[model samples]
Target: MSLARTLLDSAATTALVATMALSAPSARADEKVSIMVGGYEKQIYLPAKLTEALGYFKDEGLDVELLNEPAGVDAENEMLAGAVQGVVGFYDHCIDLQAKGKFVESIVQFSQAPGEVELVSTKHPEIKSPADFKGMSLGVTGLGSSTNFLTEYLAVKNGLKLGDFTSVPVGAGTTFIAAMQQDKIQAGMTTEPTITRLLKTGEASVLIDMRTMEGTKAALGGTYPAASLYMQTDWVEAHKDIVQKLANAFVKTQKFINTHSGAEIADKMPQDYYVGDKEGYVKALDAGKAMFTPDGIMPEGGPET
Candidate 1:
């Protein structure tokens, strides 16, 4: 089978990456492979962070460095600039760049669905659904980003044209919270921890939650592949073993997260990722745990659905 097909069909096992000893040495054993991720703390990309925290790359004899960029496209740009070997970003990017003739390939699929939720500030009881979105200011991660895409999709799904509601780019972390706290936006698209924090403060409530695959399918009308490890097709071709090793670690990490408790998994993550409330952070993580694919493969018809 072709490498791409091999990876796409990796749902059954993870032995593919262990063939490092048989690999042609395109990269030195000590070479550091930099992976740029959209956001480090969002629960959607937790497995990527978990792979790093558990020393999975080191254990596999691969030196992988994961850099965080709040906007996923920024991480993709970093890969294009030769600053990173791979980008852990939304799977739609592979299709986007492919259309532009760049032909990026997703080697490891992370989440089967977009782990985002539409939140409306408690102050605006009148703004309940997208029907009420007309003339309201909605928040997204950034213009032309995944969060923005979801926001736009939501707008269209509600039978209102894109411009009926204005989308302002309010980021995912603290910025997302501040937008709600200060009432800068009536509704916004954000991910976990931020979503969890908003509810804890009683300032925001879930207008549309897509943290679960079922919720994502219901909200987007299909499965929207969220996070994955992707790079230029040429890059993967040249560094097959290195890429495979990284994929192996992530597949293992996903399994670890599935079998473990949220608090135990959170313990492996950076302390700063927490919402300053341990219980809430764990609760958020638990809510989001089901989003990760067990074998690190995108589900059949994942992007299409």
Candidate 2:
């Protein structure tokens, strides 16, 4: 071939390569979103973990990071400080933040039923109902936690006042176990699979199944409002597409979880998350599934209640 023809062919090839590169889908830097979880290895936040493990976030072109923290006030503070783009926990905290002029919004509802929380106590077996809580020292995650709110609501519903019982802020997870064992508090509110473990070990007995209580509707309306994906209103507005994509991914993950068995869900989870005990994980998953909503939409009054 002539030198001029060779040069032209080379130029055409380069141009074609450039065009293909430009046409191909690129990684969306804006799609990277950080989410804070209530606690590590808790079944309540399983949907977020499942979404990450199942590549649902990646499927939606979002790079999601899950940050596990204590709960309520701490999570809200982190989100307000911009350490996390969103939070997966009680919606009431979001409402509280909003009331404080923080301007937060819930994108999805993870748990509609109060599947995990319970007022458990081996020390007070006679305390079968909320009325018995008077004069008792109750354990709570923190002052602004759903546990605290529920405890107060339960007390009020039982014709008692907030100060009727003393509430000690026993942090969630291992800390709660320690507090219980040390008898730091008489009764406490906690979630599974910790609750499951606690019951299995006989460390505590459920005094009140908040799940069956009528006050649950008033506290969180009819929706349990256990956990959700919340973000600052401004941040959500700035990244509307990314937010929608993330919600879509969560919805997909939730559907997948609902259709599949617990063992199947465990198989997809990391060894650390699943802990090699399929049966236990399955049971936990079953419990968790009951709380999950198939659709990602936040239930009405979830934020306000």
Candidate 3:
């Protein structure tokens, strides 16, 4: 072969190889991202679940592993320890972690309203207003959770001092129910589908729908900043495209959920996740639907009153 012809052929080969390399799938394909959830199989983590079930994450070219922890700080710790790349929980907890230099950032707003955190009581039928909480024993998940904070906020708003009410940490779910049944607490804060079950069994009654409260609306523009997607700020910065893709997937799932009815969501959801009976699941789904926004914007001032 002539030298000139050979050189030309070599150049063409190199160009073709370069193009193929550029067009090849990313090397990061094998990379897996861990996502933390506060609970296992709960409706609060439905967006992430739906994203997995619908293959949205796979469509985005990501391998997402969902890890469930006992909600709150433990979940945050898993993210901090690099056990997970992200977490789904209260936006306030993200803020709190950020305040403590945990380097967490909220990627998407999941639940726009406080769907589950409610004050319920059958004994205090007369306790219709926040003011009635005075001298009441309120059940909370823990000391620094959104539950405790909101209950305290309610007390403050109602012209009652924080000391006026006692907050008993019931650890949520069946624990909250057991506490209520034992008369350990007169009022309790909890999320559905547990709340629905409690109400159905006449164990408790809804005293305040925090999702629809004026203060909550004022905070989140009629949306409660209940839960959201959170990630380590470092991870987000290092994987901007991936973070955006994840958010996009979640947003897609949110839209799909909104278009579907309660029965549809229940059908798609695993039976184990529905803590309430089927009817309770439907009620909770109907009530919780309005709390999730189609878009993933974390409203200013947090979730609505």
lDDT tens digits, residue span 183-290, model 2: 787788887665766777788987655442254554444656667777787887788667667667777776777788877887877776654455776786765575
lDDT of 1 by residue, 1-305 (tens): 44344434332222233233234233335678888888888888887889988987877788878898998877777888899989888887776665565657777778888888999999999987878999999988877788877787787888899878888888888998898788889999998888888888799889898999889878877777778888777777787767777776777787898899999998988888885877888988887888887777667777555
Tens digit of lDDT per residue, candidate 3, span 1-305?
Answer: 54334323322322332233222343234578888887655566678787888887887688889887745667777788888888887777765665565655667776766665555667668677778888888888777767777788777877899889898888667888899888788887787777777878886877666544353565334545677787776787788667766766777787888799988877877787776478778877786777776666555434223
Off-target runs (Cα >4 Å) in candidate 3 are 1-28, 212-215, 218-222, 300-305
Cα-based TM-score, every candidate: 0.89, 0.83, 0.81
Q: Each candidate: RMSD to true structure? A: 4.1, 14.1, 12.7
Span of 10 residues, lowest total lDDT, candidate 2: 13-22
Off by over 4 Å in 1: 1-28
Pairs in steric clash, model 2? 217-221
TM value for model 1: 0.89
Top candidate (TM-score): 1
* Position 15, candidate 3: lDDT: 30
